[model samples]
Target: MSKYIIIHVFVRIFSNMQENSKDPITQSNEQCSLTMVRRVAAMLDLDSKSFSEGDLLPKGWHFFMLAGETRKSELRSDGFPGLGVPIPDLGLPRLLLGGRTVSYNGDIVIGSVVEKTSFIKSIVEKTTNSGPMAIVTIQHELRPISETSPAIIETQTYILLSASKASNNSEKTLSQPIEAEHQKNIIPDETLIFQYSALGFNSHKIHLDRSYAQNSEGLPDLVVNGGLTTLLLTEYIRTNLGLEITDIKVKHIAPLYCNRPMTLTAKKSETDWKLYVYDNNNDIAVEAEINVK
Candidate 1:
């Protein structure tokens, strides 16, 4: 039987097992400063010269500033906060950011103190062709400390890997290169990864140490920041399409390594849009949907 069918069957069975039993975990409210925003934009090589204090933060930049887990002493060798966040144990040794959606409800200023409340939303165990893995859903809501309403809510999932190493057969699942004509391409180099990692204060070694990623994590090369790709699509939607975004939904299909050129593609879908990012090899790396009004 095919892996997708197996995954679907198990997902249907386990869907109910994962439910709302856990309490919400709230982190100390963190301050959103202009310095942090500009630093992130600069690291992503974005044009932040005109950025000001009270302007609404562009899409995806929130990943850099909000919901920060501040336990430095708990970091694993790989730089992940080993026990910092409440991700379900798949008995897996590896973790990857699968994708996320940011729904904007309001705005925040540079000096605004924002409160972050997060919880473990769900945990779905599936059998992949390579092995068994778990898809852990986590939700975070960010609001100004002074306001009772949330400004943005981010829903993201993480892929937990069971095997200590990535499987070679999994590489065959890649589809033919995307040949879409109307798309913009951006080159991601090692430096970009460095800047982005710093901007997000990410301690994950996968983005910085190519050797560790290749040897320890079994990745082909340095993985670009998934959040960066997400924000890029959001920014493109804002500037090129002139869309006023209300919601974003995304899923990571594959990894795009440093030194690869990523192609961004989007098409209108009713009042919304479907977007994709293709890696240098032409495989769709990320799939996304943007709802605009």
Candidate 2:
């Protein structure tokens, strides 16, 4: 049978399953631990003593608290813990972080107990040029126990694809160097990748297992976590540019591998800031825009 016919039949079957199913929702509580904050700061080579109890948790730092409490047997075949809520088994094996949007409304203080609610916002299956794939959007809200409103709301988009679609090499041509007002270069090694993955409770083999990344995923090396790249950009804005961000939208354009030097650059405009992360090959890997107060 032709590929289109296969996709059509597959979608029809899944649509029937979806019609009988409901989106999953989950809720949990966690302490905004000062110890956890310090650990994350130390992971980034920052002064752990700089943070203390009652201090407002840094934006984007909530990633650590949003990790799913999935058990060993519940983890996906790729070692991914679902987005706090259960993810439907769509038969697509390879998963990628497509993008995320974060909105900061209130402040979450250290030492405070916060309630997190996560749910599947949407799931759409489609036929792509490459093959059949699905896009899943998961939304999470974190509210301080002492308050009535959520302090942080975030939506993460994940793309699921067939393993046969994995690529071992860059498919696009190298582009010209990107020029920005401020730029920093750093190499992401195994230690950094491992630390970030551990901090976020992300067991995705792409960021942790080299053999799985290479042989299974057809990647050159372990992939860097997209959330880590966003955290770096936000930290740069806060520490280097002295700006307070209110919102951020991030897009992962390409993958950045471990032990490779990636450049972080930011350009300030009248209203917002634009950030770009260039891989070792000088190609844009991540693009983001920050709205500051």
Candidate 3:
């Protein structure tokens, strides 16, 4: 059958399923664990002693609170836990982090209990030249038990694509180098990738299993977790610029592989700050805009 006909049929089938299925919403509670915060600091080679029970949890560090507890048997074939929320089985096997928007409304203190509410915000099915694909948006609200209002709100978008053959590395192209006011370079190794994945309770094979990444996903090596990339950017701004972030929107343009050096650059404008993560080949892998106080 022709690709066009296949996509058309798939779209009709998905539409029927969409009409019958309802989006899922879930609520949970987690402690802003001081131990976890110290571990994260140690993982980043920062002083673990710097984090304390009463200290405010750093912005973007709330990712661990949203980690999904999906059992092994219930995990998706791709090994994604869906960030603690149940994702509909849309018949699409491949998943990628398209981007995320995060708003910091207040502070979450270490050792405080947090109430988390997560729900699917939107799902759209579309046809692309590669094949039929779906975009899923999930939103999470985290409020400290002591406060009535949410401390942090985050929306993450994922791209779901039909299974396909492994990608060819030779087809990759480099992006033009970006000019920035400040920049830092770091090589994300297997250890860093493993630590971040473990902390977030993420078991995605693309970030953990090398053979699966190369043979199954057609990637050159294990891919870096997109959340980790965003965390690093936030830390850079926090430490180097010493700015307080109110909001951020990030986009993952390309994948950054483990063991490869990636440069993080920031440019300050009159309004907000722009950040970019350039892969080893000088390709822009991630882009973000930050609004600060």
- Using Cα atoms with residue i matched to residue i, what is each candidate's TM-score against the true structure? 0.83, 0.91, 0.91
Cα displacement (angstroms), candidate 2, residue 48, comes to 0.8
| Candidates sorted by lDDT, best first | 3, 2, 1
Question: In candidate 2, how many Å is residue 104 off?
Answer: 0.8
Better of 2 and 3 by lDDT: 3
Q: Residue 266 in candidate 3 has what lDDT?
A: 94
* Tens digit per residue, CA lDDT, model 3, 113-155: 9999887777788776788889888888999988998999999
Q: lDDT of model 3 at residue 171?
A: 44
Q: Candidate 1 residues 9-128, lDDT tens each?
A: 234122222253444464667778788888877775567677888787776677765435657786655776532256544577678998887898887777678987776666777776
| Candidate 1 Cα deviation (angstroms), residue 156 | 1.0
Q: Which ranges of candidate 3 are over 4 A from the true structure?
A: 1-22, 170-178
Candidate 1 local distance difference test against the native:
0.74
lDDT of 2: 0.86
lDDT of 1 at 77: 58
TM-score of 2: 0.91
lDDT of candidates 1 onward, in order: 0.74, 0.86, 0.87
Candidate 3 clashes: the total is 0
For every candidate, C-alpha RMSD to the true structure in Å = 4.3, 3.8, 3.9
Clashes per prediction? 0, 0, 0
